[model samples]
Target: MSQHESRWSLAHTGNRILLAVIAGALIACLCGGTDLPVATQLVILLGVGGVTYALVTLLHRTRR
Candidate 1:
């Protein structure tokens, strides 16, 4: 495998995806992309992000 591929582990990829999700959500909120209130949006974002992180962590551990 290429050095780049070896260095880019599953855990790292998962983190990047999580970060992207958070950034996108923030952008959407700031841009008024949704009708929901800011507090509601934040709550939804946290719930989704928490579940996604848990799933990623579980998969990473199982692969070991």
Candidate 2:
């Protein structure tokens, strides 16, 4: 692929990862400072992150 395409792909991936990390942190906060189950919280966080990433990618692509 061309340099531009590669850059765009990298940008998209970076955005997804950044958003996912933020979402995970938010989820961790929502879980509170307790020693309880974490799997569910993690799943929810990941789901939200994935959706956000997808929407962002779509918007970026369309705007181009």
Candidate 3:
């Protein structure tokens, strides 16, 4: 594989793990009986995390 592709693959793996952890945290908070307001905040966090993950992945792919 080319140098750039290898770098991107590493980055993508790390980002995927980070995103998964964020999602897991959201789920855990909801399951823990957090109140509506706090649960809503966790939902927002999930959304932002998803978007950021997507953007970074796209940018990495485009650089190849």
Stretches off by above 4 angstroms in model 2 are 1-12, 33-36
lDDT of 3 by residue, 1-64 (tens): 6455454353767856586567657665655675567667666667766776777677767876
Best-matching candidate per lDDT = 2
Tens-place lDDT digits, model 2, residues 17-59:
7876787678767776666567767777778778777777777
Candidate 3 has an lDDT of 0.65
lDDT scores of the candidates, listed in order: 0.66, 0.71, 0.65
How should the candidates be ordered by lDDT, best one leading? 2, 1, 3
TM-score of 1: 0.57
lDDT tens readout by residue for model 1, 22-42: 755765566467687877777
By TM-score rank, best first, the candidates go 2, 1, 3
TM-score of each: 0.57, 0.61, 0.52
- Judged by TM-score, which candidate is best? 2
> Model 2 — TM-score against the truth?
0.61
